[model samples]
Every structure is written in C-alpha cells, then in structure tokens.
Target: MTSTDTATREETPSAHVGPRFRPDIEGMRAIAIGLVVVYHAGVSRLPGGFVGVDVFFVISGFLITGLLVREVTTTGRVSLARFYARRAKRLLPATGLVLIVTVLLTWLTVSAVRWREFGVDVVSAATYVVNWRLAARSVDYLAEDVGASPVQHFWSLAVEEQFYIVWPLLLVAIAWLLRRRPGLRPRRVMAVGIAAVIVPSFAYSVYLTSANPATAFFVTPTRLWELGIGAFVAIGATLWTRVPRVAAIVLGWAGFVAVVGSGFLLTTEVAWPGYAALVPTLGTAAMIVAGYTSGRAGVAGLLSWRPAVWVGGISYSLYLWHWPLIVAATAYWGELSGWWGLVVMAVAVVPSWLSLKLIENPIRFAPALSRSNRLALSVGGNFTAVGVVAGLVLVLLVPSTSAPAVTGGASGSGVSGAGALSGTSAPAGTVDSLAEVEGYVPSVVDAEDDVPPYPEECQVDQVSPDPVVCEWGDTEGDLTVALVGDSKAMQYYSPLDAIAKDEGWRIVSMTKSACGFHDGMQVASGEPYTSCAEWNDAVVENLLDLSPDVLVTSERINDALTDPTDVTTRSVDAMVEAMTRQWTTVTEAGIPMVVIADNPSPGDVSPVYECIADNDGDLAACTFDRERGTADSGAAAQLPAARAVEGVRVVDVRDAICPRSRCVPVIGGVLVYRQTSHITDTYARSMQATLAAALVPQVEAATEDAEGS
Candidate 1:
C-alpha cells in the first residue's frame, strides 16, 4: 500500500540527475508489489511475503530523500508548499479514490456490525494516521480475534506519509544547523540526522517487538528505522559511484537475494521488522546503491526488463486495489481456496489498471494543477474531504436495535435465553426473525459487545504474568469456589457467581486470556507463550495456598507448542499429560476440581453476528456442523486428564449451547455467542439456574469429600 509515485511518475526521481528516471527503482517496485500480492493471495510458500512492505519503505525513503536533497543543494532552501503540493498530487488522488471505493465495497458486501469500525478506519486512513489507530487496536485483547479490516494495508501508507511530513522538516533543520558552518558538508549533517532517527527507532523496535509484538507491527516508531535506512543511501549517493564495479555487482546480486529470500525465509511467526527486518531493508539499500554504481549490471540489469517496469508502473494502484478485492471476495464466497484467491488477485489487476488510467493519471498530469501549487493542494484537500465524508456516511449507516437483556424468566413469564431450552417455558423469540426478534436478549448487531465486564486486574491479557484475584458472590460465605484457566473459564463467571450467591458460597476468579491452567509450554504468534506459562505457575501457586473447596477450569485445548528445535507442533497426548499433572497437584492439596467442558466455537462459521444480520429470517444460514465447530474445543483431551486425577470431575453443559448436532445462531430467545466460543453475558446469566441443577451437586460432593479428608 505504500509507494512513492503512481504509474506516470514511475520514471521520475534520480539520485543525482535531478528529475532523471531510474528504471532499476521501477523494477524494484514491481518486485516489492509482487511479493506483497503473492503473499496475501494465500501462497503458503511465501510466509515472509509481508517483508515486501519493508522493501517499499526503503524505496520510498531513498527516492523522496534524493528529490529533497536535490532541491536543497540547488536552491539552498526547501520549498515546503511546492514540495507538499507535488506529494499531494502524486499520492492523494489514488489514495482517496481507493479509500472511498473501499468504504462503499465494505457497505455492500461486509456485515453492518463491522461498518462502524471500518468507517472509523477509513477516516484514520484519510488523515494518514491509520498506523497509530491500528497500533492501538493490535493491543486490544477483545479486538485481537476480529477480522482484518479491508483497509488495513493503509497502515503502511500512513507510516510513509508521516515520514514524508517530518523527514522533510528534519532535513530542513539539518540544513539550517549546517548553514553557519561552511566547513561541514550538508550530506554529512544529514547523515547524522538520519542516524539519529535510525538508531533509537531500531533499538526501540527490537525492545517493543519482544515486549508487545502486536502493537510493534503497526507503530510508526518501530518502522522509522526502515525508512531511515533508505535515507542513509540517498545522503551518500555521490560516494556510491566510487564503489568498485565488481563490488557493485556483488552487492546488487547479494541484495537481490536478501530481499527476495527474506520473503521465503521469514514468516508471520517471527517478531516482525525488529532485527529480522534488516535483511530486506538492507537488501533494498544494497540494490539501490549498486544500481547507482553499475548501471544496467547484475541485479539492476534484470530489474530493468520491460515486464518488470510495466508492473512497477502500476504498483501503487495494484497495491491499493488488491486488498479490498480480496476482503470483499472472501466476504461474499466464504474463505477463498488458494486458486480462488489467485483468481481474486487477478481480478484486482483490471481495477488497478483502470484506476491508474482514469483516476491517477488524469489528476496527476492535469495542466491546471501543475500550473498552480495552491490549486493542486486544493484538489488534494477535496479528495481527502470526499474520503472523510464517505467514511462517516458508512458509520452513520450502521444498523441499531433496542433489544433488552435476558432476565431468565419461565417461557410464559417474560423470560429469555437458556430458560426456553431448559423447558421452563416456551422461548420468547422462536418464531421471530433476527431482523425483528422482539424478545431476544441482545440484537445480532450488538452480540459481540454483550460480554460481561471485569476489573482490569481480574482477567490478565497476553503479556502480564501476575494473577489478580476478584472475589464475587457471597464473599463472606464459608464454602469457597475458585474459577480458574483462560477466557474459556472466565466465560462461565456469570453463572458461577449466581450459583455462589444462591448457595451461600464465595467465588474467586483467576483467569488470563489464552493461558489455560496447564503445566505445558504454549505458543502464540509463533513465539513461546512465556507469560502464559508464568501466569499458569502463579495461579497454581495461588490455588495451592488458598485451597478453595472446588476449582473450576476450562480452556481451548488445541494450543500450539514448541519442540526443542523451536518448531511449532501439536500433540493431544502432551496436552492431556500437562493437564493431568497440574490438576493432580491441585487435588492433592485437598482442593477438589470441576472441569467445565469448553464450548463449540462459531469462529469457523461465517462472521456470526453479520450472518444473523443478513439472514434474520433464515437463521439456518448461520448454522455450522457441530463436529467441525467443536473440533478444536479440546474437551476429549480434557476428559482423559479429568478421569486420571482423583477428586476431580467434569460438568458437561454443552447441550445448552448445541441442543441438536448442529450449532445454531440463537437459542431460547437469546444470542448464544458473543464472539468466537465465548457466550454473551446475558446468555451465561440465563444459564445460572440450568447450570446450578448440574453443578451444585458436584460442588456439594467435592466439599463433603474435602471436609472428610
């Protein structure tokens, strides 16, 4: 999504000749765009295809800096107005067009629930601040599992735009600092300024990538060094001509290997663009430097081919058109197969070609705009205005409903949720469609937000290891119940709390997202889940110390693990063994355990909330095969451990979720799932009485056994 120029400007910008063309740079753009396109098209062989963006970052930095430095050396000053006008003319027209088109595509094809978020994303993209917005969302635990935004690729464009704004000012400042010192060359001072950006930004990238990798991916600070690497090449362009011809050839070929090879070697599992990013960025730098020293030789010669240049010509438009097409196609036809993905990518090229011809070229080459900087700036401003207004319109169009929360009454008593399935009364909204489900607890559009609220300290996120306890129910009651494990365990907190209050028992909640109460190592984002392991240890220690009468635990069991070689592997036997050891340790301390089986996830089905919104009358469209939905639940693996451990029993209440073999969208006048496998707070609350019928006896028996022992 990030590029220096559109098709017509592909031949523009030179390292030394002012406005001379650089065919090699054009070819590099083609390669970069190709890597990104292929990677995103579901090519399993190109796990590191995302590194293409890093390549673009380098190219953008080099070309833009070269142009600015040329102007600086010629005029002895930077013309801020004209500089921005040129940028606006080149980048804004295509970007704004893409944004408006993407918003409309989302409205027509995607679910209404996502429209508000996507609309907000569009505005951020228009303002060139989407990188920061995406960074914030990356660290949000609730948003982590949501679908990718169609405009998510705009984050790279945002990073480059931020650089375009600040890097020029920084160059001016460097020139100003050197004005009085006649002995200093401007390039040296500029190089020092570039290093100032590179060093700390790179150090922080490495630090943050390890500490919070998700946020690190989208933040501009972590990626600034990538652009700075290219700036370093531009500042030293004159000296690159002195590089020995043989060395230049070696550098060009080696750089080409590094850039393309990194795409094959790297995967999303690695902490991105930290130290790992150096391969592609440095490789790009080498290629550009080599091209300057030995024109039409080695890698430069290959890149100068006409086909490469043609693709490079349309790289910007291609990058913009491809992602939205993929997103929309996926929405319409479900998860695309590899061939279908390739077809979608091919289809995007037509629009890319059309947009470059009809939208980008006409605006960029218009005589009226070229004649006046103010006119060009004004045109760019209007494009941005159109984008912003379009995005807001999408936000305004999001659907809303006024459904009430379930109150757990008998079917005839204004009841909703699990009560109908429990045969307490006929469910209230069985005959009503999703569009106008009068008695539903939460409208379909609001389902994902229907989760129960928890104190920040109570349920830890992926990064933290400390276990913060929250006491609920009858806190002063004698009998103690502790809820433990990951978010799966946390989902049952509402029902458990209700049961605790009615039974005069205290409830202690100790849970972490993705961290089950197990002794085995877990993997997340291809890295060792060190924090989850630490949290598990801490929670086990807390449980042993408190020795609550009963400990309830559940989690999605199909967690990835790292073998000795650091390769990701999965083994049900390993999970069972780990659970057995952890559960035995707790039960040995006279604390009986109750394992609430994990629920079937709706994630494999279409976006649940959206599907219901579209098929309000035909809810069957939202149904998924029961076996496929529960395949990853890990309940079968859990039972083996539960049976092997003494004083530990399992409570199976899945019937309340999937009464028949198929998992349904709604049950008993209630939206069953919030997101993924997690049930809505209202649905969980409605299950209080049903859960109590099955769970109270087990808790009583466990308590009696504990007292007798």
Candidate 2:
C-alpha cells in the first residue's frame, strides 16, 4: 500500500505501525465524530451520542499500543520522547488555535461574568488537565447553575492525553521487568499489565458513577479502562487469525449495531463510562478484530465508504472546532433551536476544514519537525504557550466592577431593599424612576456571591441522601421555627435569621440544592433524583419527631417530577399533590407551617447578572415579564397546596419582587436574584420587615391552635 493509504489507515494521535492501512478504522472515526457532533448540537434524537468519545478512546488505545509493541519487539526498548513528540505534532496545532479563538470569542460575545471562569477553564484545557477542573466544578453546589463552558468538551481530550502520557512508560516498565525471563514474551506480560489497569479502573468507574456521577463523568481514572480495552485487542491481534469467518462476520455487524445503537438507546440520564460504557468500547474492539480477521467479509464494506473516510480524515479538527462555536453562537443569540444548532455545526466545518488543511496537516507532516523530535516538541510548546497567554489575557480583562460591602437586612446605608416597596422604609439613594441598576447594594460582578452565609456543612448537596440540621439565632428560646425545602427556601434564611433573633425564636434549617422537600421523586440532570426522595423522607421523619412549633417551607418546583406511580411528567398537578400530602403529615404532627411562595425567576435569560453588566446597568433591559416569571414559579402549586392543608399559611412577597406586572432585577438598592431562580442574600435580607409583617401573625395563630389542641 502507498504511504498515503498507510497514513489514512492509522489516523489519530498515535498512528498504527501495523502491516496494512485499515480503511474501516478511519470510517469508524467518522461515525464517532458524527455521533458527538449531533449530540452536542442538541439533536434530540441521539441523547447517548456522547459515547463517541469512549469509542475514540478505544481506537487510540488500539493504535498506540500497536505502535509501542512494534517498536519494543524491533528495538528492545520503547522511546517516550518520540512517542510524545508524535502525539504533540499530531494534536497541538489545531488545539492551541481553537483555544485562542475560543478565548477571543468568549470575551467578545459572552458576559464578563463568565470571562474569569472561562479563562481558568481555557488554561486547564491548554495544559491537558481540564478534566480534573471540570470534575471539581461538577460537584460544586455553588456552580450548579453555571452555564456550559465554551471549552468544556476538552475534558475528553484531556483524558486521552493523560492516557497517552502514561501508557508508554508503563509498557516500557513491563517490557524491562520481563526481559530477564526465558519463556515469557513481552506481549503476555503487557497483557497482564493491561488487565491490571482495566479491572480496578472499571470497578472504580462503577462505584464513582453511582456515588457521585457528576464528578465521575469527568475524572480520568473512570475512563482509563476504555483505552485498556482497545489495548487488549491490539496485544491479542495474533489470536484473531484462528477465528472463523462466519463468527467474525456476525461479531462485526453486532459490534457496529452496539456502537451506533448506543447513541439512540442511552441518554444523559444514564451514569456514563460506568458499566454502560462497555457496549460501545467492546463493540469498537469487535470491529477492529473483525477487520483484521475477516477482511472484506467483515463490516468494512459499509464503513469504508468514501464519505465516511473523508469525514474521518477531518474528525479531530471537527471535534476541536464544533463546541466553542456552539457556545459562542448561543451567547450571541439566545438558546439555539434544533435547526440553529445544525446551522452552527455547518458553520463550524469552515474553520475545521481550514485548520485541518492549513495547520494540522502541514505541521504534522513537515520534513523538519517530522525528522527532529526536539523541533516538533518545541513547536508544540509554542502553540501551548499561545493558548495559555490568551487565557491569562482574558482573565486580566475581567472587569473590575467589585463593589464595597453593603449592610444587609434593614440596610444601615439607607438602602432599604424590599422596605421601599412595602412603604416601610426608603433608601436615600433609591431612584424614583427605578430605570437603571446603578447604586445596587451588590455590584453586578459580586451579585453571584451575594448569597446567604450558612455555617459550613449546614446544607446537603445534590448527590447525598444525608440530612443536615443547622440552628441559628436563639438556640435557647421559647418557640422553635424550622426552615425547610430546597435552595429557594434556603435563600430566605437571611431575613428569617434577623426576625428569629429579634423575636427570640430558635431557627432550624434543613435544605438541599436542587431537591424539593416533598415526598415525590424529582428529576435532576434528566434522571430520577432518588437521593432527593430519600432526603425528603429522612428530613420529614426528623421534623415530625422534633415537632417544631412552625415549619417554614419554599421551593422552586419548576422541575418535573416522577409521580408515585412511576410516570415522569412536567405537569404541576403532581407537585401540588405531593406538597399537599407532605404538608398534611407535618401539620397533623402539631407543627404548623408557613409556605414562603417562590420568587420570580430570571426565566430563559442565561447568566442574568451578566446581562445586567452588559447593558451598562440598564435594569430595565434585564426586567422579565411578571406573568411569565410568576407562572413558571412554584407559587402555582404552593398556593393550592397551602389551601389543602389546615393551618398552613403562604407568605407571598411577590408584589415587592415584581411591582406593576414587571419583575425587576433590583428593588430599592439591592440586586434581587442571585441565580436563575433563587433570590440573593442581600435582597432577601432587605425584605426582612415585609416577610415578618406577613409571616408573624400567621405563625402566632398556628401556635395558638397547637397550644389549644
């Protein structure tokens, strides 16, 4: 076969040094990239298309292992310098260019609020360590509502790069240790080493995916076994010669089905790269083995089609360019529709083709760099430097809009937040027009951090079923007041804290992010939130046992729920029923309740604080329609549920939050919403007097009834 054919046969970072170029492998690359592209583009049909990255991992392992094995058998030693140099030349040019482009695009198009975090992500991506960064952020409760980073897809690339860095050294060590043996071949020893890796890694993947899927999805250890599966196939290539043609043909087709069908059958709801990942990785192994053993009789005839090969030729560049383009487009024009996502994919191809033609190929195949490992490594370093420098520049460019600390809850600076609306108090700086966001208590840049300060470990996170009960204000008091529900209820704690201290009531808090306090199954990340259900049961049991004087609850029940009968739907009827049942149980136990109606959301407006910053503090531009915000809030269910339970009163400060049919971003001098749905600590604290005026009388009435009973 010609050199061109050979190169095409062993595409990707580590090319195969095997006997012949396998066109089927290149075609597989096309299939893999296509699945990933469609999935990222929001094509609803292929929810599990993310399995494409696992397939690429298998392919990389097979090719890289084969290359290392060949070098070892011929020269008696593996060269780490040459192997890594080849990887750098094959991958870095396009990656660096894309990183730089993403940085500039984000700064120009996305909000300044995202710039600092995006810059950190870009730097991590440039260094091929972004997966760890993403894993950390994935489990961070504060970052739960953060938008997708433009370079977030780099996590997979990071995993593959990490594998490439370590695999050769491991093989070299195994080969040396087995060198002193007489009968043992290095291949056999390598096979043992590969198994050692695959078993523990797969076990850990299963464990972590179950216990903490968010972190599990991005970490390196959980994915190492996928690459090892490919390595196993490469090491055992000789055994495939004995396989019968009929069996090989059957396996080939089955393997193809497993890979393609996984994209359709699985979804984002499934815990990934755990046992579920076996379908695609093993299927890839089967295809590679079938190609070697059965040749033309295998699935190669279909996979080796011209279009497939052409697409495969540019898959790497295509993968690098597609995601950032999608993010940038989304930032420029709101969330992309299915058609717009497809359009963005098409637009991405222009840059993908240009980078492949002008940069990726020419540098990868250049005579000087190809001949000298030192020169190739140097060029790679320069490219990486470009990406890192660009990232730092973006970080430095983050606007210095930090505001001085403002006194919260009955603002000492005369900035009475909700007091202005309730006619209780008005800020000296309060604008009569309320047209702009200037003089806001928390500057737009600091708005995200303007959340209530709970004691450490006071609130449970999304994954755990464990309940945390924290007490603030008058631990030794005559009356017990409990705050219960999701983060929405947690946001109201500042105002309650001030009231509890003033009234000499003990305040108890039990809250979890993304979890409602009702006994219904909620959905998180498109899957049944079993932990949420468990937490609800556990917390309710504790509350019933404690029999607090009054239970104050609120939640953003906008998420869908799985009914008791196991049908998941977005209908609020299920939530209303669930809330009524739970509230009845608590009220029957002599714990009267106050339901704080959920506040208006910054619905569909991504990065709400950023929008305020971008508009030069024009709060009017950031105002959402009151009808839309209120309809989407949990008040739809909260109001009805409160009526169904005796002694359960609802405290609605909606008028203070959204005056005159308009939900404003700032009230009085305080910025209101901290995230998409939850109000800021400053805003909640500002609304203290209003909440107390509405809440205390109801609590006293409930207390009197409980005492009489």
Candidate 3:
C-alpha cells in the first residue's frame, strides 16, 4: 500500500508473473529460526525471542499467497491438491522424521509420566492440529502446568498448515463466486476476503487476549491478522519509484532492528501475539519490502550472505531439532545456562543437517515423489508411521504394573514404608509409597485431579456461569462438609472423601476451574471473570440457605487476590478485604469455614517428574528451594483474610509440604507434587492422617460452634 500511487495502475494491463526464489526471504527465515532457537535454548538475552514465530507467520503469508495469486492470475485456477502436495513434500518429510526420533528419544530419556500426553502430542503434531489441542489445554488450570512437549514447537507449523488449508479454499471460493465480474479481479477478490478476516480477527484477538490470554496465544483466529498482513503485501504488490538510497538503508536497518531487537526488549509476561506482535510482523514485512528496492545499502546484502542463506535453507529442520534437544538438555542437566545452552544448541545442528540431507532433501526433491498423488500417499504413510510410533511409545513406555503400592511400602525413593525419613512421626504424611509419582507413571501426568470419581456434579468450568450440582460423601451423614473454590480446592477431594466416609460426614464440593473465591479479585485475563463472580454469588446464596456444618474452601490464591499494582506480590490486605465479604455471609449465618492453606509450588519451570526421569531417579536433584518454591503461593496472603472473619479457621500445610530446607519431590515415600503446584490425589489422600490430625480438631470445634448457633 505504501509502494505506489493507485491512479497509475488504472490503464495498464497487469503482467502476471511467478515469483523468483528470493535469497533475502531465506535470510529472513534464518533470522526467525535463529531467534526462536536461541530464545528457547535460554541462551539469548532477548526476552522476546518468541517473536521469531511472528516473523515466520508474515513470511508464510507472503510466500504462500504470492504463489496462489500468481497461479490465479496466469491460469485463473488454483489446484488445492498440488498446493497440499508441495506443502507435504516441503514439511512432512523432516517433521515426521524428527517426530519419530523425538518420540524414541523422549521414551528413553524423559519420564514415563509424560509419555501418555506426549503420545497424544505425537498424534496432534502428525495431523497438524496441535495448536488447537494446545489451546484447549492452555485454559485447563490442571493441564496448564505440565512440561512442554518436545513437539510443542509444532504449534507454529500447525497454525501455518491450518492457514494453508483454509486460505486457498477461501481464495478459490472468491474466484468462483466472482468469475464473471471483471471489476473483481482474483487478487482484488482475495484482498477483500482477507481484509474481511483481518479486521475481525485482530479485534477478536485483542478481546480474547484480554479475556483469556493463554487460549488467545495458540488459537488461529488470533494469529490470523499477522498472516493476513503478509497476504495483503503479496496480493497488493505495487511497482513504484525507488526511495532515496539513504532513506531505504535507514528504513531497512530500522526494520531489521525491530525484528531482532524485540527479543531482547520484550518479556513473555506481557500478553502476546496481540498488539505487541506488530513489532516483529511489521519489521518482517518492512524488511521484505525494502529488499525489493535493489540496493546493497539495505539489509539485503547481510540477509543474502552465504551463512544466512544456508541456515535459512535448513531452518525448518533446525527448528524441529532444536526444541526437543533443548527440552532434553534442560531436563537432563537442570537449567542449561551460559555456555551450556549454546553447546546444547550446537549439538542440534548435526541431527538437523542429517535430517535435511538424509530425510528431507531426498524425499522432497526426488523425481519419483514429485507428483501430487505420490506426495499425498507419502503424507498418509508418514502419518500412519507416526501413529504407530505413538501407540508403541504409549504401550512400551508405561510404568510397571507390579510397582508396589504407595503406602506402607518401600520403593525407589529408598525410604521404607510411608516415611522417607525415620525420625519424624509417620514422616508427616501419606502416599501409597513414593512409587506413584516415583514410578513416573504416564497416567499421573496426563490425568488431572479434576477428572471423574471424586466429584464433578457441582463443578463449573472457566466460562460456565451455571454450576453443576454434584454430591459426594456419605449420603445420609449427620454432618455436612461443603468444599468450595477453584480446582486447588478440589485437590482436597480424595482426602475429604476418605474423611467423609470414615467420619460419617456428608461432603458437598462447589468448585470451578481456575476460578478463585476471592470476592475482590474478579477472575479473567484482565477483565472480570463474570461467570466466576456469578457462580460465587450463587454459592453465597446456597451457603446462606444450606449453611453446612463446616465450610472448607481454598483457591489458587495467587490468581484470586493478586493485585498487579502491589509491588510486594503478597496482597494480604486486598485478599483479606475481598475474602472478608464472602466469609461474612457464612460468618453472619454462624457457619464455620476453614481456609486450608494452598500447597507449595513444585516449580513450574522444573517439574520433578521430568527431572527425576532425566536424572535417573535422583530425588535430591529434583527438590526445589523452600523459599523460591513457595514464593508465588497465595496461601500466605490468604491467611489474614481467613483470620479476619468470625467463625473462620485456618490450616496451613507449608511445613508439611516444604518441611526441609528445600521442597523434596518425594516426601514420606510419596510424590509431593503431581504437576507443578497441585498435590497428587494420592499424596493428598495419604496426607489424610496428618490432615485429620491438623484439621479434625478445628473442624470439630467449628461444628460445635455451628451447632451451638
């Protein structure tokens, strides 16, 4: 749009032409992949290394749309089969090879607990739908904390493939519908369609980002605008008089700076692929546009240099190789920093180059495999192979069925019976044995505590305004114990269920995924989680009416009352203020509620399951520092609020969770954390005795107070 005057094109017949292979674009690929690899390896100073994916998005939009536009201009038709064949040839060979190898290596090196989800990741990546699957997983608070899958990088590829599938069909539809209209040329029709999508997609991206940032990051529509910008550049290409050489040089250099420097300047903490993404997308588009001006003064010379072009040529393979290697490196070595990160990155090149030569080039350019049908068959074969590998990994990589029960048994953790330690009383908790997580069971990582059997009848999802009514505990028990809050509260279910049956208490759990019970904090991306507020309102009404014998509630406190404005991060005052109102309803009604302190975080960046697997069951190496481990826990902040109310009791398990200098991965012969911060249901169940010891007395006192009232 900036290149030429629209009036000059009124009389000239457009010369339809195929795009020449631009080395500069290859250079751009090098830059994009370089940023991505370095950032992911944790070797770069750039916090925004992820912006490289945005550059790739723009480049893909430009290249793919250029091909389609050229085809339509010359032949007035686009072949979906041929386009897909090319994509399959260009992408699938190396992708499938890497996926198969990654699966094998992950099985050998990573934990068994990750195998099941990684198995699904294999399928999702093979089918190029991993982005959507990841999007669903992102919003799930339970699944949200697991380790990054080796193929998680495939999400960008999945987005591009999804674009490829839809863009051509949309262009073809526009062409067919406008066949007789000379005013609506194929390029113009395509432009109109793309414009139609870009405006709403960008708007939705901003809105959804503010509402659900995690889902927005992976969803296609949110990323559509960045790609659409590239498409616009391709279809709207205009010839123009060159700008002053100095101006072009400055412009190109500036654009390059924006693209590369963004990584150093930006942090992942900010909401992304939103407006912030414009920095790299525009930078990429500007670089491409400036390259066309025919000058050595611009970035053209640097981008087209031999090393840049070569790296760009193998960038796809490198991208596939780098992430898995980094994941493995970090898992094995525990935080690959300084020279170690670079060494890990360098090792990936050998496999990347091999894939390029042995797997990628041979199949991609082979004369026999060039045909669309042959390529289609190859895609099918590769997909089938991947599926088989996934199945085998799931079957063979699982934990031993004969593994000893977690409780009162000795296992790999080396401590006998229930206690990893002999001096402490029953070693402070229960776990069947440390073998549950110590075995690195695939099901443990894959199946979140939020799943069935415990209770889901009254569970509310993130967006569900209405709560489902589910009942648990002894149906006719004399006393009622109502559990409430987010999935963090639901983590207590197994233990509470056990206690309920044993103590003859009726248990009713009112829970929501990711929603907190803090009245002051409206849960949403940046806006109010209207559903959570409504559900809280409804729960308050229910509590007013039912007023169970005892109310036990907990939330992802950090999510609940975390005021971004508070520099201290511990917003006890705000939490106390917000929670006081919610507690008031129960307090005024003379019902006693217990605010069970949230558990210590198991370190999201370094899950013990992965670390233990990587280090050959070295439990001490998997432990997280006590101070750093529980820093984000909302438990401390929630205390004042719980204490502020009448008829409210507090129960903190911090000592139980992080009893030593560091929070051990395996405690009392049981896995302490299932994923990141949530306690394993087994671990929670095992803590029943300790929980009963700490909780039963207070709960009994509360029940007596309630009965007296």
lDDT of each: 0.81, 0.80, 0.70
Worst 10 residues of 1 by lDDT: 426-435
The list of candidate 1 runs beyond 4 A from truth reads: 6-17, 136-141, 337-340, 365-375, 401-413, 423-439, 474-480, 499-506, 546-549, 558-568, 602-607, 614-616, 624-631
TM-score of 1: 0.89
239-316: candidate 2 lDDT, tens digit per residue? 776778888888888999999999999988788878999999999899988876666767977788889878777888
The TM-score values for the models, in the order shown, are: 0.89, 0.89, 0.80
Distance from true position, residue 695, model 1, in Å?
3.7
Query: Where in model 3 is the C-alpha error above 4 Å?
Result: 1-18, 239-254, 387-395, 405-452, 455-481, 494-508, 514-516, 519-550, 555-563, 566-568, 571-585, 597-644, 650-673, 676-709
Candidate 2 segments exceeding 4 Å error: 1-19, 44-47, 136-144, 207-214, 264-271, 335-340, 365-378, 402-410, 422-432, 436-438, 476-478, 558-562, 565-567, 605-607, 613-617, 696-701
Q: Pick the lDDT winner.
A: 1
Q: How do all the candidates rank in terms of TM-score, highest first?
A: 1, 2, 3
| Tens digits of per-residue lDDT for model 3, 362-473 | 7766776665566666664676476556645664666642233443322334433223343654433323223334443222343243233554445676766666555677
Candidate 2 clashing pairs, residues 3+ apart or interchain? none
Comparison by lDDT, 1 against 2, better one? 1
The true-structure Cα RMSD of candidate 2 reads 4.0
